[model samples]
Target: MNISPTDFASLLCSRLCHDLLSPVGALNNGLELLADENDPAMRARCLELLADSAKASANKLKFFRLAFGAAGGFGDMVDTREARTAIGGLFGDGHRVELGWMVEEETLPKGAVKVLLNLALIAGDALVRGGRLDIGAETIDGHVEIVVRGEGPRIVLDDELRGALGGTAGDTITPRAAAAHLARALVTENGGSLQISPPDAPALMFGAVFNAA
Candidate 1:
């Protein structure tokens, strides 16, 4: 789990680029088709596709900004509403994954928010066949606790990612695990602990707790 800061940053950049490539590529392809199409109906379809792609790209960027970046210039604390919006946009598309946000705090420390978002991202992705993603967070006695649960017909939590979240990825860390590594690092830095549901369980759940005092 130990890596140079520069290398870790490169991994995060790779992950962001990989996730964005699909929608961004679709936008480029749609624009090209719109330029060449003669039929009005086909042109309209291309435009619709372009719009969807743009929205998807934007949503992913927003999620990553909070989960991995500087929170879009936000201060030491970030509004919970922004985190909710980002998660909704990332997983609420076409109801592929339903989101249930239960965080009551209006704002949380930046480190806590990042941990929450990254863990939610991991849980959401585990629902390979689409399902429910419930995220809950709260502060008790100056400590932040976050829990993300994903239940579906099929859940796929990559071993590397699980290891990363548990701070045991060792030399197998990759771009796909960048978020998990970062989450674990932040939690540990703040004297926090993480928990992952057993692999045989029907659902995937992640819980994190860190000192926010």
Candidate 2:
């Protein structure tokens, strides 16, 4: 699948907007309710809801900056701790999901970081029932290996996303699967490969191998 840089950027923007719509919309609605509510206690609850929505909006922007934009410093490597914080913030506010960080490297190449973040995003979404997400990455023998696992009572991965991750989406690509497509593109461009667990598998998992040097 070949896409122009402009088209790819548009797809990413669309995906970001789609993910942010709910929280942003909630923020708007909360403000309207707060303005109309006269009861002190109810107004307090509205304020709380507004705060929660604001936090969610901020978290999603932070996550997208690193995952889909040219964030971090000008250096070739990005701090893994930043990645951990971004992931935690995006999925930890409501405490619906658990995160397990297994990477020991202090910093990773920007390409690897983006791939890891995007994979984590996909895995986190697959855990529709709010499950545990484990993310790990390491560089060994000039190769960077990334893995993300999502476990829950029920896991669902859309076929389009699976195909996009495997680099077989062909002409059926959509904005929703843009992150998976980006992950595959980054790995393949770095002379590596991407893999995903079978759809029937008990757990959803993603694996990628790319040159680190």
Candidate 3:
């Protein structure tokens, strides 16, 4: 409710520490297992686990580095093709949601790639049941249009998720809600708008638009 600046900072640090503990712990456990094991095969498996965990950690850092770290490095306009490839590489699972792209002669404001990546992550999370993702971008009236569509079993569109995309968090927001809320806030802070459109049939579509200067 009412937190002083010091208390708020403390809370933020606690949250970050809590979030990182699991992966760091996994790394520690994997190292211990490697040391305890005598078989080469077992050590190899532990190394694999360590490698996977490290990649996950690095991927997340890269995602956040661009989304929340700095701006104006890529320039006033972003390359759609490169953005699509980078985002897909981080989130694509091949079998589950097939990541498809349609970026023909289109670019957006400097922060557009971050918004697109956020949309892809949100979309990928929604399609846990395996689906197809169609990503596209276009420039219309000095605004960049981006769309992410999913086709799967059913669409789950909750109010909190919608609010998460709106860049606001409610009292009962979950961890996922907070992450998405942060993403939306980052996009909105960069002068963009997010929209989630659930299909009447069996599909989910979410996207965003940012004005280009």
lDDT against true structure, model 2: 0.92
Q: Name the lDDT value of residue 190 in candidate 2.
A: 93
Task: Report backbone clashes per prediction.
Answer: 0, 0, 0
- The lDDT-based order of candidates, best leading, equals 2, 1, 3
Which portions of model 1 show Cα errors greater than 4 Å? Answer: 72-75
TM-scores across all candidates?
A: 0.97, 0.97, 0.73
The per-residue C-alpha lDDT of model 3 at residue 118 equals 61
Error of 3 at 100 (Å): 0.9
At residue 96, candidate 3 shows an lDDT of: 62
lDDT of 1 by residue, 1-213 (tens): 579999999999999999999999999999999999999999999999999999999999999988999964755888999999999999997858988889999999999899999988888888888999999999999999999999998999878998898877777588999889999999999998999999999888898888985
After superposition of all CA atoms, the RMSD between model 2 and the true structure is 1.1
The 0-to-1 C-alpha lDDT of every candidate, in the order given, reads 0.91, 0.92, 0.65
Q: Is candidate 1 or candidate 2 better by lDDT?
A: 2
**Model 3, stretches more than 4 Å misplaced?**
1-23, 71-75, 93-95, 105-107, 154-157, 166-175, 182-193, 199-201
Predicted structure with the largest lDDT when compared to the true one: 2
Residue pair clashes in candidate 3? none
Error of 2 at 12 (Å): 0.4
